[model samples]
Target: MTADSSLLAQAREWHVLLHSGRATAADRAAASAWRCTSPAHEQAAMDVERLWALLGQLGEQPASEPAAAQVRPLRRRRSLRWAVPLASAALLVLALWLPQGAWMSWNADFATAPGEIRSVELEDGSILTLNGATALDWTISEGRREIRLYRGEADFQVAKDSTRPFFVEAGPARIRVTGTRFDVDYDGQDVVLAVTQGQVQASDAQAQPLLVGASQQVRWSGERLQPLQALDARQQLAWQRGKLVFRAQPLSEVFTELERSQRQRVIFLDQSVRDLKVTGVFAHDDPQAVLRAIESNLPVRLVRLPGLLLVSRS
Candidate 1:
């Protein structure tokens, strides 16, 4: 039987926590109780265990070696009372080393690692600046310059070519421009376009084309495009200079951007804190400092884990 996506995710989380080498007796008990809540939950957990066994057998090193290395520093006390099987911990190690965008990185002609920004000059003289964890493929034919942004954000400085139009396909949004400077941020769910110079035509499958000029921005989602809104292009595109600027955004959204620069996952233990508003100008180079600043200003505390950070109410 196919397991529900939400239940599968929960099962994965439980497996990670149990094998993290920090699982307490209480944690194991809680997991057992969770499994007993529903038969579907138990089946999901069993599926995860089977997946772990396959990964362990296919892994190059012993199943426990990687997990031991990762959690050694965090292991202040031994949890001898609750022992996890070697195969069960293999998935935790894999999760630590591989990101969700691994497939995108493999398929992209140009891709940037976490916390890495890259600039490439096309043969057509256009400049493309990729943000951290970004991936895209480009095709420059005699008649057109096309870019497929698989994930993340990018800034484009299109070279004027009257005979060849520039096109960017990101998720459900389609952008067209002949010669212009613009930034496109695709986070899988939404595509946001910001024009710094010249004009850009933004559209989706079911919406009319919208013309966005310099200092304007538009968002495309769910087969619809939002009306253009005025923005300071310079401030919005400060990420090119290793800076991040946010204006009254939610804490969860801020953390999403921070993850691109920090190369770490952020988990909110208290859901209420996700909606807290955040506004600041932070240097992307020092994500820890940025997190500290947020903690000082907001009513939240940061907990560092093996490969992720947890946020909780102060």
Candidate 2:
């Protein structure tokens, strides 16, 4: 396994141990030492801890349940060492196997690496521009042309094919358009649609026939589609022109976009600093240089570690 993946595995182990309420002082000390070895390790541990907390919230028991009149002690209690690993395995499956999109991209017909932009002509002469780290598969059948966006984002300039309707699928949401220009992004949880020209129909498992027109955007989850919101469609498509524009966006969001464009991992240590608003346009050419520009404007310090970048308050 790569060094980053190895560290993540180790961190998950620590998560199960420490959160099981069975860790000794020595074990806690060891975990601290491991985190100090690298920021990547710390970040992985943080992710596991966050997930564990969320699971606890979801598994909360009812407060009004009556106590059993006759209580029988179990012959033996199962060790959490085994139990927590099972739960962690489920979490891993959800991260890799579900709609997060990494696994699906392996079979994509067209893809673009991080920081690389490419445009291709479809069989029907439509132009598709894939953003960095994006993957998709397309098929043109007799009556319909379909594209599945597994990860990242894409801009479509559909050809005038009145006979074959075009459709783009991102997770549980679908976008249907005969001939239009628009953008779609699947960011793990939500499929975001932005229309630049003409009108398109967006639908999900729960909602159908939602219309999106020029200069409007909407977010769709599996069960619900958000109301259309007004936005500058051109500004949202700035990535296609090799630039990233942020308007009062959080530092965490900026870091996420930066990581994707640079194909590098970024670890933010201070949660309090994550929500600071940032606004600017930065080139996607060199991620390190882009970060330096951010540091100059924002009150944050970045530490470059092997295979990862650490963000902390200045």
| Candidate whose TM-score is highest | 1
What's the residue-level lDDT of 1 in candidate 1? Answer: 56
True lDDT of residue 67, candidate 2: 55
**Cα lDDT of model 1 by residue, 1-314, tens digit:** 53554676788899989999999999999999999999999987886776566556544343243554657653443333123433334544454445545677887899987788899999999999999889999999889999999889999999999899999999998999999999999887888899989999998988888899998999886757888899666566778877888889899988888877865667565789999998888887877777878888999988653444668899
Per-candidate count of clashing residue pairs (backbone under 3 Å) = 0, 0
Per-residue CA lDDT of model 2 for 169-266, tens digit only, reads 88878789999999998766678899999999998877768999998998886547888899675567788777888889888878777756764556
What are the runs in model 2 whose C-alpha is more than 4 Å off? Answer: 1-105, 221-223
Clashing pairs in 2: none
What is each predicted model's overall lDDT from 0 to 1?
0.80, 0.74
RMSD (Å) per prediction: 15.7, 10.1
